[model samples]
Target: MQSCSPFDQAQRGDVEAKFQIFLTLLAVLAGTALLARRVNIAPAILLLIAGITLAFIPGMPAIELPPDLILLLVLPPLIYSASVAMSWREFCANLRPIGLLAIGCVIFTACAVAVATHYLIGLSWPVGFLLGAIVAPPDVVAPLAIARRLGLPRRIVVVLEGEGLANDATALILYRFAVAAIMTGAFSLTKASGTFVAILAGEIAFGIAVGWLSLRARHWVRDPQIEITLSLLTPYIAYWIPEHHGGSGVIATVACGLYISWNGPLLISAATRLQGIFFWDLVIYLIEGMLFLLIGFELRAILERSQGIAFEDIAVATLLVAAIVVVARFAWVYPATYLPRLLSRRIRTRETAPSWQAVFVVGFTGVRGAVSLATALALPFALPDGSPFPDRDLILFVAFGVILITLVGLGLTLPALVTTLGVARDGRSELVFEHENEIAARREALAAALTSLDALTDHRELSNQVVALLRARHDIRSQQLPASLDDDAYAATANARALVRELIAAERKFIHAQLRAGKINDEARRRIERDLDLEEASLTNRESGTAPL
Candidate 1:
């Protein structure tokens, strides 16, 4: 029987189904986002859990959001959004460790799981490797998103994101090779290496072409809604264009994502940038939320497939594979992060390359979710010699086991690890972020005070009222600032803040110069950006407000 689903209904051109599921998911996302500040866990993970609970309800047919559709339609926006938010320098600094963990660690993890499955779960070597390939890539969205929101160190966040970005290609490369070997009954290291290289090169080439071409298309269009719609379709174009020619869709999508934003300053207008930012961010959130939810939703499907497998064997194998993944991260991360610094002869580096706590945090967060489970589930539903795919049911079982062990175990454990590691120590980072907000408050008060002083020249009637309001604000900030800061720290902080204010004023001077020279205009987005620039200036700058002479 055909599965009944919102997507299926939508396909039949049911307008209600088209919007209903999307609107409901969006509303849920909105509610979760509102509560995100109060809650420590990521809203994506929360959504996944909720989706799983919903899936267990009686008479709710499974919604099969096709894996390729998610890959082609969804992943690009999320990757692009993350890329735009990334600072190039921070991402570059962590590039080495990110490569080691994403590529080398993914390989290690796949092998670990494959071995465990072959020996412990009684699967053949190639079949076990196929399972390994599935669960190998670590899902960082759940952790990295939470870490970024909590304002963890930029370096840590960059490393996690960088790992997340690159590991897709790594795991996909492995998946492709393992699946091919099973399908063709032929496997060779030399051939696998060749295929990997081709996939990488082809993906990069395809992305560069699509990303640049998309920008060109945007130049001819002025409508924000149309541009945004075009932007939404871009990832799929990038993915499918390459895949049709037998290239890696995952790498192509990621490359296209990075290319678009990496060239944003040069290629994108301020209006386009603003709309693109908002558009892609919303799309990414929806896709990321749905992707994670699907991971949990498919848990039932996995259990159904693995029903004949002995629970005792599956449990033991999962534990062993889990241990391997955890230990392998520590094995790789500690050594890899330090090796770079140790190798640097002249430049002194931080002694703590990656704190044991950070290493442990990354290690424990080995949660295998969407990519792993999807690749596993998508494992060719056929076998070599035209027979049914060999042991797909068992392979799916082990893949699910890997995911369940990693996610349920690590997701629950990561919070305690955070508390223990003191990464978010005393909740001080939140206070720091909030302080800038407070400073903005003080600036408004200063503006009102100055405005009041001016109103006296025009009319004394309104002047006194404005003065009274400004006076109240001054008194509040005056009392609050001291309690919130130590004398030396406040003064030093103020001096640092003053430097930033001067720097921004200096930057503004150049920007205005460019405007006068006809290089740019003070457009709507520039006004918004100006506010952000000043807010950033105040966050780091210590200068008191004063009227220009």
Candidate 2:
């Protein structure tokens, strides 16, 4: 009987089984997405349900996500992506509300949950506080999912996004302090507050530095492939550097992401920008799907870990804690939403009073997600004295309960809430506004190009054929810009552009066939491919009413 290490066995594990699981999971996610689309429901909620179902299948392997991996690998990129995509202008416009929700509401919720857990459940104070920290921050993804689908108000979306991006950092900081207090049996409010301030300041500085340096490097490395690679790596580096030095990596990653996004036009090529968007969209899709599935799989382990605790007690505790989590958000959100406006004449003059319905929706949308689960699971298994961590399993159970209740309960009802509140959907108006802006810019650019063409041709020798071709294209484009942005005019332009795109696609297919048949050399194929790519990109830009830069 030779001894084989678990690491060795894992390395030599059933490759086929792993491959089957990957393929099956992808299929499941694809199917779930289709169902979500068909039903007009949030895909994430569906994915979560599917994942839970999958966990109960006989002979399924136990899937465990290491806490550090979630914090370091998963959290950073997801946070960075959301932060980068955020409109800094909008974020600033809603800064007061965002700050109230992200910082003030998170602490308020934590304290409320802590009190409920300690008094109602009879958990130790530190453990109760630990549980509070775990569930304090609402997951940004779920609310944003519904917001995107429902075309919710921009202000609501911005506030939710800002809270999502910043709250995790706050909650996690408090979580670390709480965990330490539990482990060491020591506590310090002044010291923790000071450290919190230091972490926020330090991480912001580090993120700005990393972003500046990375952007400079990206400029130096002009290759699109390398630039995109650096873009993918940037989030991780931004996050890790801060965490390594006792700073809030969430803030650091967000700062770096925002900086790069703000300067993206100057730093990145248009092709890279297009490529990066597609890449990140796919990455986010896969990660979100896998995350929900993992959450579902954890159910079995979470249940099993609570062997000593009575099932009835667990049920009661889970319900009470979840209720507290929901009520606490409402407790904070209404005051946070309106109190500033009432007290400050400056605020009152600057901002409108949000409707109570909108405030209620915002409050109800606070769904616990992966961060809470990751933090709960990341709890130490045992104390330094070799005793088991107090109520660790119970904490995990409660956290998962909150996630399920909020994501399923709140997410499923949000559509009706929006309808009842009569929140005006402005997504279409925003698109029209952007389209009009693009047209105006294009009209000006064409005028300048024609002017420059006349001046240059006057000074230098030129062929009539070349001049006529350039002039003809610009003239046709100028004509395409309708005098009025009407449906009929837009449709006419779209139909014309569709023909151009079809021709480009036909040319690409023919070229691809030529390369496949070995009629073209790699160099020749590449040259043609580059031309085809530019043509396609331009066509896409035109159809989307974007600048063809």
Candidate 3:
């Protein structure tokens, strides 16, 4: 049985009142976010801003952010949704780089900031480490949204996403260890390492098992609404299963997401896909919308508590930390990538490897919002000795400081960084379709030649030979088109071929430029782009001889 969250205290005897409160909160924040959006602001951004603005309103509700609010209520589903939506192939291809950035650089940032904050800021190393741990991992949603809007390079997206996906596990690991140190007044390197490994293994195992169980449950009861509800619960199951056993909730959620969606093609039938996509889409949209609003709503607490320190001190520190994070990212990114390639004498390959400028752009893209603030707010109010948590307010102040600097600072400069970095000098995406077009054209030619001979039925043996060859052509074309298309439809279809050809040409220019500029290696680029080429090509041929445009 899943354990109820500590926050579920409200969900018990006062369940109806708590439920009403919860629904009202969601409605108000969601509604305000929507209202703000009508004025051309993003709803999520509006949600946060509006929520914060409302905090000052007289008698406005100020919800205390219990630890369970973040760890249990918000995190599980968000993490699971990301995992469920993750493209496994992208994850695999970008694994090495992701590991380097997420783990190595995360650890690096934590250590760097720990030293800087401890000695310079005059805090205990453990407290400093906690602060560093919170700031090191870029908020996943922030970077993902920025990357998407900037129309950044696909390779860059992989790095950002790769780092984001894996770093959650790393940051959470460090956070756990740091929390342990604070709680027990002792830290163990060997024990930490052993614990990390155990948590990793446990999460992977637990998540996979739960996902498989969920998949079976879905198979047994294949209702779309139910499956989505199951999908919704998967994250919680993945999280609580391991947490119940003192395992990594982040890893468990990720593992469960991957497995549930692993056999997406095979497991989710056509009927399920239609229902599942809509169901999950709505669920994710609602979650994302509400979460950002919660961020602002949560911020009101931080603002109300900022009495001891002047805005100037907070501003200066925020600026300082923000600068350090950007510098630290570049300091960590370029060497982390290129140094390995230099050692192996094996040029690192990708659709777009991180250039120096790209590193700078990515570094600045670190907008610390949800996770950092939440971590700070969630910090226990008192230590085991019942002493006020050391540097607690300072940490909270700096957390907000970092968010302000990154969001306002980098957020404003992001557009300029895009052009300066030349990351997208060619275009946003690097999908190549020319090869798909060629294959399509060839298939069309072969089919046309066969059709020409089809009228010669008097020659049975020749006709049989042509038919055999045409069957082979058909098979080849099937491999080239998108998974959604059936061979008969693709080949017999008229518009498919022409549309595929145009898309392929656009892609060819994009891919070839990146290839020539050393953005992507030949082999990796080709492999990364192989299916797109095939799909586009086959689809093109199917439409090749359609009546003249």
Candidate 4:
């Protein structure tokens, strides 16, 4: 073999180093996630801390997170996943509130930041507005994860999730306008407003078109693997088209996901849904964990770059901006929640106003995350004239500070706030109500299926034995459903599920023994193992209250 050239050797060394770094990061992510679960803290918090620790360790390489890596690669799937998971009916029903928060609140908060920074920090208006837009939206992934576990009211969850889905579009649009104004030293409210409207309309139309085409294609393919591949591609298709043409891409992805969510159930096959759920779940989990870690790692680089700025000044700007973000949300949320009903009689008749406690919870959950930092980092180092961008380092430092404070401070205290306000009690009651409705729906569906089965039996020639077996199976399924969601009934159901799980374990043990003894081939064993695996998974889901009724 010939000796490798020096350049080739260097290339090989670089690749090896990168691969090692990848493995090390993966190890950190896994450990942090497990520790978070054990300590009953949000994983995002721990992941961020872990990343900070790793970043400062001697001899550890500095990892640069490209702005596009987050904007182009990570964001689409996260937004799409959330949009798909959201209930379309609930989303539409709460559209007014969602829009207020997603659109109006973002605008208000951005403007608040702009004014505060201009007067207090002495940044120019355009640069201040740009910073405002960067930090306007609360992170969807972090707060929703915590809120769902706390069992807040379903409507609150829906509104928060819905707001999170669309707020990025609002913030990003404003960000672009602010950037443009700064670069050209001019601004136009009228033209910008018209452009904003046109982008929204165009993206929505494009997103729906993408969703429709994707659904039809998946249905035609009829193969689970191919359908899953298409599902993975759907969001990118929806996002990239709009983004490439000066739109936010967020609205288009959200619209696409919602369209597919409402329409997909009837078109998608059971196998595809089943496999796709697991695939997407794992994908989102890894992506989210890694994103937070990378965010934490960015701190070291930011600190290194901030050598020229006074620590005291950076701290003051960060604290002031963070305070403004929190206070402005409360000021905006209360009015936004109640002002419409106050202004319109028709609104009063159509909607019941939420409690003050719930509104407070919404206001208190303004945790920021990766988007603000990414946007700030994406800011140009120099203006179009090759002059240094004013206050660029300060902007980056303050943005990071705001993210750290909100994510750690507000996120940690939210659960206690909800508890003190007795929101969890309302959430529990809502859960009970939902469980009752689910039971009723299940019974109605079974009855309908049985009625159809009877009609088919009357119209076609069928053996009595076959008809009897089918009837017995349906009866067994109906019997398995709990009569009510009472303590005694729930306990009985849990005990039964535990017994079924034990039986499944025993079956697996026997199957493995037979395989070891050469009683069955690998292929046969795998076939049987797959069936058993699915059955066990169903039981696990049912036990955890995640199974579909």
Candidate 5:
């Protein structure tokens, strides 16, 4: 082989550099998480601050963020993770408010922000609208994590989650229209409206098709490794198919995630289900860490790149736009939260009115994040005729400013706000409710299993030993729970199961010792071990009052 060329060597160096940067970022994240725990602060907020600090250090590597990376690499899995894990029941029950906020409130906020930008910031209508689109939707990632940690009311969290999932598509559609109008200097309201409808219908249909096909494919392929790999690909396929055909990838991804999430219990094996949850959780953690860190990196880069705009000027614009975003949310949320109940008797009767305090928390937690920065950066540097994009630098700075203010300012303050408003839900009550439901489900399942066993043991060909063993297992399961379990009864049931699990563990250790001593052959040992493995697994599920695989 010929000696490697200079270009090849350079390429190798570049790759090495990138790998080093990735490793360093991971190290930083690990350190930040530990430090955050020590300080009793949210890791996300601290990680963002750490990233900004890293940016300012001397001789630090400059990480160039590609615009498409956020949409393509970062968005799909995050959206899918949130969607699949969301409560479809709660989502549907709160559909009215979610729709009003995701659609109507998005439009309202965008319009209000646009008018503010035009009049106060002196930007043109199109550019102002573009800015509005950039900041319209609160990012799902940060707020959801915070809400869950703070233990806010479940319904309020659901509403926030629902709005985060749905609003991105709406804002993106508006962004596209505004960009088209700016570049071509032409737009049609009627045509845009029709296109919006077509896009929505097409994306939803596409998502359903992807979800259905993927689930069927998963069922046909039984291997856990293969199934888990397919799961990793599901969100991307959901996004890619729609986006390739002129539809919203965000809508497609969310739909597919929701579909899979709802049906996951039926389709997935227990092993795959557990492994997949762990894998996705890890993936989400890494993605979010990098995404927020990159936000800080981008902030410094954009500010440095901005020309002729004073720091004070950018600061003022940021403050004004930030104030607009917050006020606009309050203005829209109060009406959107309560107006439907006032107008429609059906809504009033079907749903309980949310407390005013909860509504305030929702309004205050509207923190703009990575998506906004990505949208701002994604704007074209030049129009078709080679003219520079109007106010691109200003828009970028403004967008970064809003993200910083919202993410750091509002994000850091959210816990205190919730505390002040007395809106956090009672953790014990929620746990008790879940325990009650689980107990009821277990009781029904055990009764059915026993009934089926009683009917099956009547077979003349069935062995008495096999039937007896099956009966013993079912009886043990039923005994692990009580006829009526209150908190104390549940604890007692847990203690009994713990004793059973310890006995199984002792049996497992004895079997392993026998295998090592060569008193048991490998084949005999494996047979016994498999039985022990399954028994232990069953015991674990039972202890938690979960159904057996």
Candidate 6:
């Protein structure tokens, strides 16, 4: 074979270097996540620190985060996963508050940043607004992770999750408007407002259509692997179609995920769901870990490029912007929480007014994340006439700084803050109630299933032995469920589960021995092992108190 050219050799070398960097990042991501779990800190925070550390290490390559990688590759799945997990009923029930935060608060924060930066920092209004739009939305991944773990009230969790899912669309739409205004040197409120409405309606409709089609196709195909593949593709199809046509694909993805969430149970198979959940969980975890690490790495690259700018000036601007972001949230949230109840007696009758502590927790949890950084990085280098984009570097630095402050600073403090304010006191009680409800529901369902079985036995010529076996299986399962997860009951369940796991281990050991002894073929051994594995997994779930009703 002929020797490769110098250009080809260089290209190959670059590819190899990038591949090595990717492998190294993966190692760092995994380690950081494990460390976070051990220390009980949010993984995102540690991952960010790890990235920053790695970035400064001698011989480490400069890692550039392309906006497309985040917006296109990373975002759709993150949004889709979150939306699917959200309860549509809860989302709709709390529509007013979610909208207040997702729509009103985003706009409020954006405007606040815009006005502050313009007056204090001397940036032009359009550019300032662009910066505002970049950092407006609270990140879904980091804050929600912390909130769920903290055991806040379910409604608070729902509101936060719902807000995170939808706010990006609002911020992004505003971002586009700001960019257009900057580029054209003119802006129209009326025109932009109407366009925004149209885009929202259109994207929602399209997203629903995508969800409908995805479910139907998956149902038709009826293969676990194929169905999972289709599910993976669903978000992208929902996202890219409207996005290419000038819509904020965020809403479309959210709508699609919600539609599927409500409808998927009946259509999707158990095998697909069971396997897909694990697959998606792993995918999201890796993506999230790597994203945070990359975000940290971005700091080094940004600092290198900002050699001319004074560190003090950047620090002051970052501090000012971060302060404004935090304060604006508090200012808007209190009024938004109480003002509606004051104005509308209907609201007061329908819902209890939340405690100020809960409201404070919500306001404090406004941690900016990767989306802000991505938006900042995505800003064009030049305007329409080839003029340099004003304060682009400053925006990037501030956006990253704000993310650091909010995500790390606020995230680390939120747990203690929730405890100090007693927001989770009711949450603990609610969880107990939920566990009891779950047990009740399971009993009711099994009773219904047994009633159906009795009916089937009477109608069909079923053998007594078959009927007895079926009834006994259900009885055993029902009996295994504890009446309550009290300390005594939990201890008994744990001991029982441990014994059962030991039994499963013994069975697995025997099966492997048989295979080794040639008493069973490899296929037969695998089949038996799978059954044993599932039984053990069920026990594990119950032991962890995570088994579904």
Extract clashing residue pairs from model 2: none
Candidate 1 residue 442 C-alpha distance from true site, Å:
18
Give me the displacement of residue 462 in model 5, in angstroms. Answer: 3.3
Q: Write the per-residue lDDT of candidate 1 for residues 327-403, one digit (tens) a residue.
A: 76667777776676778854244444656776666666677767776776677776656788877776666666666
Clashing pairs in 3: 433-504, 436-533, 436-537, 437-537, 480-534, 480-535, 497-540, 497-543
TM-score, cand. 5 vs. native: 0.89
Of 2 and 6, the candidate ahead on lDDT is 6
Better of 1 and 4 by TM-score: 4
| Least well predicted 10-residue stretch by lDDT in candidate 5 | 540-549
- Candidate 2 Cα errors over 4 Å, as ranges: 1-13, 426-435, 441-468, 482-549
lDDT, candidate 4, at 304: 94
For residue 429, give model 4's deviation from the true position in Å: 0.7
For residues 412-436, write the lDDT of model 5, one tens digit per residue: 8988988887887553456456667
- Residue-by-residue lDDT tens digits, candidate 6, 179-291: 99998999999999999999999999999999999999999999999999999999999888888888889999999999999999999998898789889999999999999
Between candidates 1 and 5, the one scoring higher on lDDT is 5
TM-score of 2: 0.89
Measured with C-alpha atoms, the lDDT of residue 146 in candidate 4 is 84
Every model's Cα RMSD, please? 11.5, 3.7, 13.0, 1.3, 3.5, 1.5
| Residue 416, candidate 1: alpha-carbon lDDT | 72
> Candidate 3: where is the Cα deviation over 4 Å?
1-44, 309-313, 347-354, 427-429, 432-549
Q: Say which candidate scores most in TM-score.
A: 4
Residue 428, model 6: Cα distance from true site in angstroms: 1.0
List residue ranges in candidate 1 displaced over 4 A: 1-38, 220-222, 343-352, 425-549
**Each candidate's lDDT (Cα)?**
0.69, 0.85, 0.71, 0.91, 0.83, 0.91
lDDT for position 96 in model 4: 93
Clashing pairs in 6: none
TM-score of each: 0.72, 0.89, 0.73, 0.98, 0.89, 0.97
Candidate 2 lDDT over 38-149, as tens digits, reads 9988888998898888878998777676778789888988988898898877887888888899999889888888898788879888888888889999999988989867
